[model samples]
Target: MKKVLIVFVFSIFMILIFTVDFPIKGDSLYGKYVNTNYQNTICCVEAPHEPDTLILFNDGKFESKFYGKGWFEIYNGISPRIQLHYTSFGKAALFNTYFSNKFFEKTKIILNADMNHTYTKID
Candidate 1:
């Protein structure tokens, strides 16, 4: 019984480690990107008011303020893909994040469509 338990625990740990890079569970997107502009690495285009507000929680949840409207999601993730289940619209929005071309420095780009309103990180 003890040997079986050990094997089970090891198996679980292996699964966890293997799935970490599977997009559904990447560890990089578990933090806050507040007051930061995730823009395209190519042109780095951003509008004056782009990315009005975006908040992604660690528990696969998100709340964003865009165009004076609240977009809430009970379950969301930014790995593998940036998917948001908007409760207000009763739908899901799949956004592809672009990265900075800078070698030493980097940035994340959360696109909606047109980058008419994204700016550099204020703080």
Candidate 2:
């Protein structure tokens, strides 16, 4: 009886630790951006813009869309550069144009290189 109970408890613990969903992605990345800045030939300081940089954590991955471009969701995986502390849109402008970021010691910002969107955490 003791061995059986131990096994049962162990199984449950494993399930909770490994099978459970951690909101790490959602908590760490999901939210709306409200300011923006464009850095081309001349770098402009922070500017006002819409929350075009939208990031959501669903299922078990991250999905970022710009200006309601759901079709680009299919390409979110175009590269891992999409999710980093600091990034450049590069030639893959389709994938990089939006959701840029500069990771600070404690905070990070995602920008839209093309759309020029910014995110501000409301929650």
Candidate 3:
């Protein structure tokens, strides 16, 4: 009976550790990200804004003044593929990148689409 109790307790502890808000490297993705190079990244000659900004929320929602508002999901281990689902009628976008815990700590994210764009985390 004592052995069973110990095993049960250990299982519960492990479950809490995994299900609870244990900090994962991907958690760093949540925050405001701004396109470092907006001018040269886009093909358009005329530019609307100097730098495009995107905000990713912890609730799996994201918004951008230039793009629109939508839900986003990241799939993978450390280096993950991010998919942005735009709810608004404007536009939708996808960005892929690899970020280690060490690299994510710097709050810098690089998203690759047609071209590689660097986004700096503001908050």
Top lDDT prediction, candidate number: 3
lDDT for each residue of candidate 1 in 17-122, tens digit (9 for 90 to 100): 6544333234444444443434434343222133455555557665556412223232233343344444335544443443222223323333532642232222
lDDT of 3 by residue, 11-104 (tens): 9988765543322355667999877665554554222236677898999998887557778777755345567676334444444454323322
The lDDT for every candidate, in the order shown, is 0.41, 0.39, 0.60
lDDT of 2 at 21: 29
* Rank order (by lDDT, best first): 3, 1, 2
What C-alpha RMSD separates each model from the true structure?
A: 11.0, 12.0, 10.3
Error of 2 at 103 (Å): 7.2
TM-score of each: 0.37, 0.30, 0.55
Range of the 10 consecutive residues with the lowest summed lDDT in candidate 2: 71-80
Task: Order the candidates by TM-score, highest first.
Answer: 3, 1, 2
Residue-by-residue lDDT tens digits, candidate 2, 1-123? 999999999999886665432322324445443434433333433332423454443433333443332222322321212332222243232334333222322222445445433454443
Best by TM-score: 3
| Regions of candidate 2 where Cα sits further than 4 Å from its true position | 1-26, 37-66, 71-80, 83-93, 97-120
